[model samples]
Target chain A: MTRAELLADDPLWLILIKAVVLLLIGPLMTMFMVIFERKVVAWMQHRPGPNRVGPWGLLQSIADAIKLPFKEQIIPTTADRKVYFLAPIVSVIPSFLAFSVIPFGPQVSIFGEQTVLQLVDLPVGALVILACSSLGVYGIVLAGWASGSAYPLLGGLRSAAQVISYEIAMGLSIVGVILYSHSLSTGDIVDAQRDGWYFYLLIPSFVIYLISMVGETNRAPFDLPEAESELVGGFHTEYSSMKFAMFFLAEYTNMVIVSMFATTLFLGGYMAPWPISLIGDNYLNTGWWPVLWFMGKTMLLLFVFVWLRGTLPRMRYDQFMRLGWKVLVPVSLVWIVVIAGIRAFRNEPNISTSQILVFGGVALLVLIAVAMLIPDKRARAEDEYLVPVTGGGHPVPPLDLEVPKPPKRRSLSEAKVARKPAAVPAGQSTSDTPDKESE
Target chain B: MSAVLAAAAAEVSTGEAIAFWVLGPVALAGALGMIFARNAVHSALWLVLTMLSLGVMYMVQQAPFLGFVQIIVYTGAVMMLFLFVLMLVGRDSSDSVVEVLRGQRLWATVLGIGIAGLIVGAVSRSLTDVPVENLQQQNAGGANVNNLGKSIFTEYLFPFELTSALLITAAMGAMVLGYLNRHEKGMKRTQKELVEARFRGEYERPSPLPGPGVFATANSVATPALLPDGSVAPESLSRLIDSTASETFSDEIKSVAGTEPGPDAHALTPSTKDTSTTDTKNTEDTEETR
Candidate 1:
């Protein structure tokens, strides 16, 4: 269908229905994803996860959802009542809004009226997703600040920095896609990918986008905000019951949004896979089948997210920030330039495949040369703290160190034989232990 | 279907009118709230609301690109930075009363009012020409993003380039401001003095409140301890519950009063009042002398 045809207005009831479906789709997908994540992670770890809830624990998320409302809702006495109450709400709204622009399939007939499977498709569909995801940060930051607690505040601050660092890369990465598609609308971008996907054409942008979307959602490896072993529960430290559940829903829903966004941009969106499309002259890419393909691609991305969460360790706050700012941002920025140049070259008359190949080769060499040029970072023994020791502590754990083991069990007389004190066991250095050891 | 859609597009929808009224006031009220909110964080949040409402208003006006950018850049990133600054500076820090630049605030007010008047005049004149109805058609819509970009880069290239230069200059100015080091009033101390100040013996890492490990009380953070040395005391105000023991915080001290030799069966005191009093007075005097 043409762009004008795609922009056709549906009946008001149909529009409302689309919105309601979009709303319901997020929570349902979140519920499914939660179970899927748990099951997959458990399988990877060799354990049975929540099987008691239902058959193979398929309905565990539902049970959790049911439990959330009945549980006692807690608002800390010291918390800023209004901000605290609004924080989770702020987080969840954008996640739901993000789902609006994600194209599920092409136009379909519903109740004798034609409408697109997606909700609204604004001109800046991809940017809307980026915008919504960016807005989600406010919820986290506010939640942390309003908690009137220490760890949550730290978590919120981390989120602020995290979002700022990753979003530039995320936006830049999308620019490459937009340059290729020559359209900002998600539907148009998907439609353009019908002949050949941008996934292969814009490989670097896709990879950067993959990393960025992970960071954007604050998922594993890049999930510094709620680094459980460090900041307690991060921004949701003071939250409990339904309010806390909202944050949980927001997180999983963002995962879905980013994954769907990736599909829309790089994975040919609702188009069937190559093997399937090749059959019957691309028959499978039509009607409700497209929705299935779109969902399948999104699901695959979600699995990748889950897989990364299961496998990789959470990144240290500084390392995560450095990766985003010093690496991903600059790389994505450079990649956009490279893509734009390539586009300009392709547009020129009489350019051969060999010339394009040579250009790609040169680009690859340049990246490699740059990589080799930058000096390797040597580990610093002194600056080992995850976060720096700043004025007025915010309750983030300092650092883990190779503390000399305590002395072996011995008689009091044997212990007393050495001049070293009981507190300073044998083979342990006094100064090596951090102040936290005193606690 | 086409006819119905065309008719719907021609007439102003109730939803559109409602959204305009709803969002316009909220955006204006958000500005007012930003100025009046007591807490710094609350003020920042109000600014966020203003930016968000404006973004919504832009979307309502059919400028999706501008609307999303407004939300993403101004509300999302810039407001976040403002909050970061507020949080970092200590959340409880209030605005200073004393105007550092004399007459600057007054000049700023006057200039702001003059600018406001100019904008109002321009908008009012435009409104008279468009009659509000044609302004809807003047939307140019989401597709205008490409047109706008093309115009700026081609037709208005010089002005756009000038704007970029101005932005670069502003950025440099900000960097320079950051680079400038302002000296504080505190006199620099020697390494030895600094070390001495930091490592205060028996009071290392003082907590802001009375909490666990201060003294061996059953209830960790609650209640102050009374010393056996005839002192109603905690030696340090710090409540940081460290592994190290206090001189007074020992299990062997028995009870503060030796009148009851319950746990250890160790310090048997005289049942008679006179003898007990003498013994306690002698111990107190000895402690004082030491």
Candidate 2:
């Protein structure tokens, strides 16, 4: 029987067990991910991470989880109390819900009943993931607005813009995968990749998805919403205790969900590697073993997430936005058109898929070269508009590239003598002398 | 997509019926809450709840593709933009008790009922006119999304293309409206102009503003800076802070004791001579304000 048919036949108690397992996976993975990320980041920087909690501070997240609820919950005086309290809950539920559609493995026998290792599989599982991630932003925006503070409000607005811009690119990237897979369901997408992964086939879409997933999860360079240096904890600036911990949990959980999602979409989901799958007539790819492979690929992506955090600095807001709208969105659009062209050509009897891909690749490269050769009008305008060395009304120092010449300094004795009216030059008034000195 | 309509037409399954019963009233309550919520932000949140429930309702109806798109487009993109604008404009930009438009509330109630009636009528007409078998025929060959795609490209092609054109126009209009002119005269002054203006004495003092609580008794913000000649420097205090030094000038001086020069005392540091000029400047400022 197909996985869906098997899933449909699950008993009430078994479904309940599946639901419970799905719920447990989010928090459990989050706990492990938190410590793992910290340890990895610490290692990258040549430092020992948390060592005091459990064996190498493994119990730290659990202790934190215990401590969070007991800590004082601070509500701002000017806060909209109802929405203020609701935001974190709103944020967390969607992150967990998104995980429900993620296929962990192929059909597995659980307590002698056959079922897919997923909580749910809708016809549009891909869109469900997108929808859930989209819904997740509301929590952030509402939290920022309800805080009744400037920083949180700014943070919320930023996140809203960030999500909206990146979501287009993200959605477009998935379209290429959906086109090849010929199905919106996550399980079907994974199944379609039996021969080869979409990541390698649709390289451009893969790269776009990789960049966008980071932006979607608010990780690393794209983490402007919670930029501590700028907005002082961004949207969660006013949240405390359990409320704050919930947001933290939601963020880490989102990280896991997106990483797993990337794995499912691009790394062949729960399928074992080529060598492992080759053994025993594809034995490792089936049942419980696939779950191990799924988790392994997910961890690899999660490590990439951590590695990015350790490597890149947080991007400037304008540059980040430009990258999303100007670079990622346009590139995704072009890539989609190219994919559509290739897909169209695949239907012709004379053309092979490989030949079409090679032709399309060459054409795209030439197009890019031509595009690059053209000078940017905006850049030329900027070059023509010379910036003044001295800061205008604002007190900005001169740009580092153009150092201003220093004013001539008088000796201390001369300065003191110049301060006296009698020692001042005959034509120069004492007031005028001070102004000259100042200039 | 027709599969969704077929599911609606068929005998109500126990699971779907249960879901409908659970979510139906929640969606109704959400709509009501959106209208009645006092705060604008709260109203937006209420609308979000309504949108979420509607998305689930679509899912429960076996149109999961439509369900997710409803969420992705409406709840995610559209309403998010709504909230983003609301946050930017003002959280409190809700309906005011004082009516700006005459009979607006009455018109709103009437128009709202009219729209609801229109919707009910339209839905009922469609249900009556369209046969379920035809919907099933449409649903025969492909998945719900594929059916949707086929219909959108073939039957609804013009409308789809029109919608895209409309969207592109809207986007272009937005771009035009938001465009910033870099070269407008008096838009931005050059650094050279600012420096020259400063040297010309057209700007305020070149020296930094004296910080609050400088050489004061309490060393708190409310305690204004004391000048070299035992006078309160008004510039040192933030307008937000209470002017405690000005109100209890003598008391504050006494509190600082001999550390501060007494008002009547003539013997003081050399800086006292320089402050005598600024002391007159302060008196002039206060007099002008008075």
Candidate 3:
């Protein structure tokens, strides 16, 4: 459908149907995301995953969904009743709301009326998604706070720091897309990329967007807020049954939302890939085919999410913060400047690819020069702290920690020195000889 | 009269009208709660509610961008920082109890009432002039993101740029002030000294074992002693009883603490035997908590 037809008036029933579908997608995708993540990660680890629940474990997530609601709800006695109860609901609602603005396909006929394949699409479509994500953090922070526990509180604090740092990069990275597309609306972005996907042209922005999306969704490596190893269950440590399930569902829905956003912004939403579009004079790009392509792209990105989780270890919190603030943000800012310069230069009649190449080469050379001049303290520090791991000897964990150490083997002479001889009476004691004398 | 009657078309749907009424009051109540809540986290939660209400209000006004910005920036990021501070600093009642400024509460009440009265009076007088039709046309039509962007760039460019500069200056000022206080604890140490101090065994390492080590992983915080064969041996130095499942005396349980288990260790009895053991356990638990 053309851009003009996006906001065409729809019957109330159609709106309701669209809304219902939009809402259902979140829970359904969440269920699918859970099983998908487990299965994919299991495959990566060379293990069979949950195949017991149903045919090839297809019904596992569904079974989990059925089980979660029936589980006994637990509320900590120390928790503030109102806020504790509201946190998960608060978290789940924004996740659903954020999905509202993401367009799945072009205008289509629905019950005799022509409309978009998805729910409402705002002018500030991407921004609405960002807002919803930001709002979702409250559920987590509140959950941690109302639990009146320590680890959950730490998890909450980590989340606050993480989202704030990553969001700047996330927001700035999208700016490049807006500048290229000349519109904030998602549909406009897709239409703008009909000829070329932004993933190829805006490579740096795409890379940054990908990184930020991982961080934004709190997926593995960047999932410090819910890092099980560090904080037990993190912010949901005190949550149980349905409340915990809400948090769990919210996380997966976020994964889907972010994946879809990445697809829409960089991968060309709903548009079929190259060669596929070449089929039947571009029949693959039209009609209901676009929706299929949209889902296909999003699921592919979601697989990447699971792939990263299975392959990478969680980052140290400081490392994560540094990556977001020091690396991603500054790099994107410079790249954005370069992109803006390129865009403005392209508007000129005489600009050529050769001229842009010259500009890029010069920029690269300067960056290298600057990097060569800067002192690397971290490298030196790493060298200083490095220790040889020899003959089962290892660095000691803190006294409070419970690291196991094996007993040392002793030579014959050393064993004699180490073993204390049992206390021997100078003469036979009464108790020692009593049993024999009595017999 | 006809013009007024015909203007009903300009109004939002009945559902939206009801939502507005409900959300408005909820927002107001949230703001009030933020002011009067007992705990700091509760206050932050109330502030969140207020921010969400304001976001909905912006959406009602046909400005989705502003609404989203309200939710994303104010409710999402800002209040999260507030909650973080509250959670990290802990539930210190002294934050509310000890008034740093004398007569602060009285002056706050006065100023608050005066501002509320002024706002109510001003809004009551100006409410009639707001054209409802323009808002309806804006919402029902295409995205107003372009219009908002155009106005900000063209009409209010200077103010926008000026505000950003102002924010930068404030941030710089804060950093400078914070940096000035860094040396208040002591003279600044050399990098070498800082590194040495941080890495020193006493400062960096934990001093004593929490208990006889029953578990260890390379990634875990706990460190245990090892045999020549690289198998863990319990230290048998713990003052408190280890109650881990591995310490249970059942067939499935091994003596993780290196203590020989008695026959009665696996069973729970409610007579003299259980009570005497429970007495000792209660003492140990009390000591542990302390």
Candidate 4:
């Protein structure tokens, strides 16, 4: 059957089943992502993770979820009650909505009806994911704001700024993928990569996307929003119980979604690996087998997330933003141009391999020459510019400690003269008179 | 007008229309409560209620994204910042109303009414001109993320980028403004210190000793005259003068005794005193001759 026929053939009941499956998969995947991230990070660090729950601590996430609602709910006195209540729901829903566009597996027969293994697909499915992720920022911003505390507000602001910054790079990074596939639909993009994954061809875009995804999801190393060492749980500082749990669930779900998206866009979604694909069509790329391939690739990316969290310390907010705007966005833009050039050349049927080689060699030469010629821009000297001391008038002397001179002391007689006279004077004694006479 | 009205009526649900009828006044009341509540915190709560009602209105209009964003951004973040600032500054509830119009309540009211009139006029004009066709189209598919994305990246790309620049500018502006306010406070403290230093430099010391002849006259007045038989008076006039002079000197010394001398100054004081005594004698002799 054609793609359209396969998509349209799903009846109402089948669609309902798909939707339920998609919805259930989100929370379940998020739970596993949480457990897997912990276990993998623990393994990397030579320690045991979540071994107490059901086998290998897999049930720990479930227990935590169950316990969440029973925990105390705290409504800050200064918080806007309605907004506080709505923020977590705002955060979690967008993540689920973004996941809805993700295609899990190939067309499968469910209840004797052939349908694609997805809740729904849009022609602009890739853009929908981006939009949903963008919308997720409102949750973090609101969560920070509704906490009605300094740290949370700062965290919210940082998250908002971080999202806005990284999102540009994230979107720009995907431009190469879109150019290569000649399609914005996630499924179409995945299908176009049947010959070769974009990760092999557009390595820079993949790297940029990988880094941006970490920042976009506010995960560790890029997790300035919830840097407990700095922001004290970041935007959701005051959120408690199920609300807090929802934020946690939203974060993990986002990680899963982004990793899944990465797999689909760059690493060929649900496609059998190189070795597995070579084995033959009978063994792999089948109904249930493709799901395993997709999950395996996505889990590898999730492991990268865990590895980053274990290895790298969280970046300062400004540093995170600088990397996004200064490094990632610029590099992604250049990479997009190069990818576009390659696509344009490839579209020419008469283009020879030598011509491609010549173009590649020239590009490499120009990159090397530019790298060699460009001067390194170091941070400006400490005294180059005076930072206007805010809130107080004097420019805050940069934190180089210079001991101040001690205050000069006055003579005792001079100090005594400065004191105000007492209201009542002591009566003069005859002894005082004789002492005065002797003086 | 009738056709447009009918179209609008068709778009709204009967249940929603009922909800609108009920909630419209309730929302207005909440807005009024926000304006009139004595406590700033209470007013913020009322504003939250107003925002919630507005969210419901958006939901009724089938714009769930806008409804949620409104609640999450404005009511959540913006209002929270307002409350945080208010709390941090410690604005007194009782004083807030009085402070709002310290000198020109009338002008404030007039300006407020004028702005309200302008908004009402603009909104009414825009409402009449809104393309009903677009509303129908928007209502059909709902405001899904895909449509929003397409519109943003394609048609509104420039505006979207501009909005991002505006946000960056705002963040930087807030940091600068906060920094400046803190700097001004520090300047004020330094100014106070300068003023105190000037006051200290202007301080003058009063003289402690009178001339030698004046002391002698004072002593003679305090002493009794010698008896004609060459016996001393029961009370000595010289003694009286000396005692009075010494008592006055001690009182003057006590009055000026509080200056804590430096260690070096304390060490040199006795030597300095001997030199000053010799100088005082020479000065006294010159003054007596003059």
Candidate 5:
């Protein structure tokens, strides 16, 4: 049966069940992701993680969640109480919302009722996820603003900028996928990758998206908002106990959402790996099997997130932003154009094999030439504007650049006479005479 | 109008309507308390009440998600930050309001009236155009996370991505702004200098000769003589003179001191003839007595 026929047959109760399942999956996956990340990072760093909780600390997150609500709630005196209280809710809701459109499996029979293994699907499902994630920034921003503290506000602002920058690169990176699939629907995009994953065909876009997704989620190595050394817990600095826990939960859930999106778009959502696909006609691709495969791919992507967090240090805020705008955005844009060109050529009915090879060769050459040429312009511009000044008499000091030596201090007599009284007490005479003779 | 009034009356009982009336006033009180509380910290607490009431309103509107978000984000995290900043900056209860209204009281009144008028007009217009079908269809479940997610990832993907870019830029801008550079220009000056420069301007110069020796005499008579014990006796004498001179010198010095050189002028010149005569006379008297 066609995909449409299968979708049309789904009952209201089945849809509700799928939605509930999806909702539960987000928190559950987030819990596991947290524990898994800690354990893996600990392993990488040569330490044990969370072995005290139930069964090798598998239930640590559960313990945390249980403990959170009971902890004392502190409201900052200078904070906007309404906005401050609303920020974390804004954060977690969007995370859950973003996860809803992600397809977990193919149409599966449940309680003898046929239904898609998703809460609901829309033609613009991908855009919905993006919107939710974008809306998530308001929570951080408002939290910072409401807190009325410098650190939280700074963190909030950083989070906002981080999300906005990486989001563009992230979106651009997906343009290639959208072009290839010819649909914005997550399920359709996954279905389009049946023959081959876009990760292989659109390698640059895939790589760009992968990098941008990490930055977008404010994960480790990109979590400037929560840079402990700098922001003292970022936008949630004032948050205590349950409110803080919600933010933490929201962050992990967001990570899962992004990973699932990456899996659906580029890793072929719910499709079994190559070896498994080769073993049988359709054993692993049907029923509950596909769910396992889908989950496995998402977990793997999540593991990569943990690995990055463990291994890489957080980038400086400027460096993180520069990577998004200066590198990822341009690369994604170029790749999109290249993919579009290739797709147009592929669509031609009478295209020859030799002509295709020649076109491919030319495309590769053009890409190389463009890549080689682009940096020179940037370098020249940077060289020309080498002076590190912000220009309000408060110039940004040059990064790692040596400032010219200030004119040497004049001899004592020539030094400008300070107009104010000496900082030393008036009773203590400033005469240069030594008391040694009297002594 | 009669049918509508009858329907409204039928929908809510007197008790329910009374409860609504009570809640409306309470919510308004909470909002006013949030704004007008003397202590900033108290203001935040009052705001918490306001948010809680708003959340109830959201619940009434069948927007549980929005209501939950309202409480969680606004009351929980944002207010906590506000309180934290107040504490961190040491804003005590004793801190006086620096400027209650400044010059904006009239402007504020005008703006408030304008806003109230606009809101009333809008509410009247909205009441006239209220659609029963739209109100009935409002519970269509599109506001759920699932629907929201689908919409974001599909139709609004570009704008969503663009918004992320905007947020990232804003974050970057904030980081740049918040970066506390200890060595930033103008901040390098001493605290005293900064305060003086900021408040005093150039008005606080010291007098050129500020201390005791500037106008005082350098005479040997004024100077205390060292005794055989190596102690100076003249400090006590000067203290005695200082105590007596203010009262005694006013009448006597005014008449007699006008003829003689002034104390300051006499103190400056050398007393050659008087010193020599006094010394010779002292030696002659000692020889005669012996």
Candidate 6:
């Protein structure tokens, strides 16, 4: 029987237990993720990290969990109290909800009752994750808006734009996977990858998914919305205590969700590695062992998240937007067309697999050539101004960047004279210039 | 669409009926709350509640794809853009109730009622007269999405393609409308112009403002710097911080400085006096007197 069929037969007590377990997974993952990120980042930077809390800072998240609620909750006087209180709850709920469709392992026996290790697998399970992610942005935007402050408002707007821009590319990338798997259900997609993962088959889609996922999650390198240097803690600037902790929990939980999703889609969910699968006619792929493999794959992707944070600096907002719209979106469109062409060719009995691959290669090369031939509108527009592009057609900063001149130095005698009551008029004239200039 | 609704209605479980009854009133309340909310953000949020309940209703009717798309497209993207624009322009810039166009409110009320009656009449007519098919049987193997895709591509291909073209045109129109001609607007200022303006003495303070100093009370950016004589350096406090900060410290400055200086008493800089020495001397002077 299919996984969905098995899921439908689950007893009420078993379903409740599964739901409870799924809910617990988010917080537990978040708890581990928080300390994991700090420890890994600290190791990368050659720092000791939070070792004092417990064994290699294992209990640090627990300490934080204890401390957060007791801290003072300061609601800003100007804030819309209802929305302000509602924002964090809005942020956290959908994050956990997105995890419902992420299949952990194949059908497992829980107290001798057969069930898939997932909360519920809707027919359109993949879109549920997409929907939840889309809903996630509202919390941020609302928090920023309800704060009644300029910085938070700006932060919120940036996040809205960022999520919208990246989500298109993300959805398109997922379409490639869905096309290959021929199903929108996460379980079916995983089941289809018994022989080969979609990542190897659709490299462009994989790469685009990687870039867009990072952008979608608001992680470092694309983390402009919550850029601490610019936004002063971004949307959560006004939030304090448990309210602030909720947004924190949401972010880490989102990281886990996206990582699990990427694993399920690209890395082959709950399936053992090739060598291991080969042993005893896929012995390791069966029973509870698949869960370990699934967790291992998820952790691997999570490490990539941390690795990216440790390695790359945050991108400029415009540069990030250009990457999303100009680069990723167009490439995804072309890739989708190519994939459709291949699928069409595969359906024709006369065309052999080898010949189809050759045809696909030629099509890809032709597409790349066409892409290269297209002149850049932005560059051409810049060229019209006839600004000297000194660094090989790249716009360079001005050679002689001017610095403001320093004020005329006052001697000790002049300063002493200025301090005298008689020199009050002279001091007034000197000070007046700066004040006037400032205006 | 009606076939899908008919199939869902045919099943009519007790739980499904309960959910529909509960959500119907909630959705109505949400819509009413949206109209009545004082704040624009609150209104938008209320609308979101309405949209979410509608999405849940769609799910309950065995159309998960439509439900998710409703959340993703309407509540997620469209409403977010609404909130974005509202926040960007001005959150507090609520619409004035004073009608610029006379009889606008009366006409709006009449038209709203007319539209409501028309929708109700059309829906009830369709419900009674339309032939219904079982979508559950068609989608027995959980092939609802696949079946929808097949219909869109096969039977309704031209309409689907036309809709995409319309959407692309709308996007292009938005891009064209938003495009700014920087040259025509003269919004782009060269570095040369700024530097020349500074050299021409158009600005009084050619350099950036001095950093906040080590005052006895605080050394934060909001705290104004202390000069050698313990008076506040007017240029040292950031204008942004100055406007929002409650403590101007005029009384504190008077006590610290001993004698209050004139309005423009900020010209006591000596090239020879180190800031650390001056700060220490000021502190010691205050301590000795105390």
What are the RMSD figures for all models against the true structure? Answer: 11.0, 9.5, 10.8, 18.4, 17.5, 9.3
Which candidate number maximizes DockQ?
Answer: 2
The local distance difference test score of each candidate is: 0.80, 0.82, 0.78, 0.73, 0.71, 0.84
lDDT, candidate 2, A1-439, per-residue tens: 7655566677889978978888888889888888888899999999998888988888988887899889998899999888898899999999988887899988878888888898766667899889989989988998999999999998899999999999999999999999999988898999999999988998999999999999998888899999999999999999999899889889988989888888889999999988888999998887799989999999999999999999999999999999999999999998888788777887788987788778878987999999999987763326533333333434443334355567678999998877777765776555643334434
Tens digits of per-residue lDDT, candidate 1, B66-151, equal: 88899999998899999998877767788898899999899999999999999999999896885544233333444545766787
Candidate 1 clashing pairs, residues 3+ apart or interchain: none
Residue A150, candidate 6: C-alpha displacement in angstroms? 2.0
TM-score of each: 0.75, 0.78, 0.76, 0.59, 0.56, 0.80
Task: Find the candidate with the highest TM-score and give its number.
Answer: 6
Docking class of 5: incorrect
Clashing pairs in 2: none
**TM-score for candidate 6, residues paired by index:** 0.80
What candidate 1 gets wrong by more than 4 Å, as runs, is A1-7, A350-439, B1-16, B129-142, B176-290
Query: How far does residue B241 in candidate 4 sit from its true spot (Å)?
Result: 51
Chain A vs. native, model 2, TM-score: 0.84
Clashes of 2: 0
lDDT of 3: 0.78
- By DockQ thresholds, what CAPRI class is model 1? acceptable
Error of 3 at A368 (Å): 6.0
- iRMS, all models: 14.7, 12.1, 11.3, 17.4, 18.5, 11.3
Q: How many pairs of residues collide in each model?
A: 0, 0, 18, 31, 62, 1
Cα TM-score of candidate 1: 0.75
Over 4 Å off in model 3, which ranges? A1-6, A350-439, B1-19, B92-94, B102-125, B128-143, B180-290
Using lDDT as the measure, name the better of candidate 1 and candidate 2.
2
How would you encode candidate 3's per-residue C-alpha lDDT over B198-226 as one tens digit per residue?
43443543233333344534423233445
Q: Report chain A TM-scores, every model.
A: 0.82, 0.84, 0.84, 0.82, 0.82, 0.86
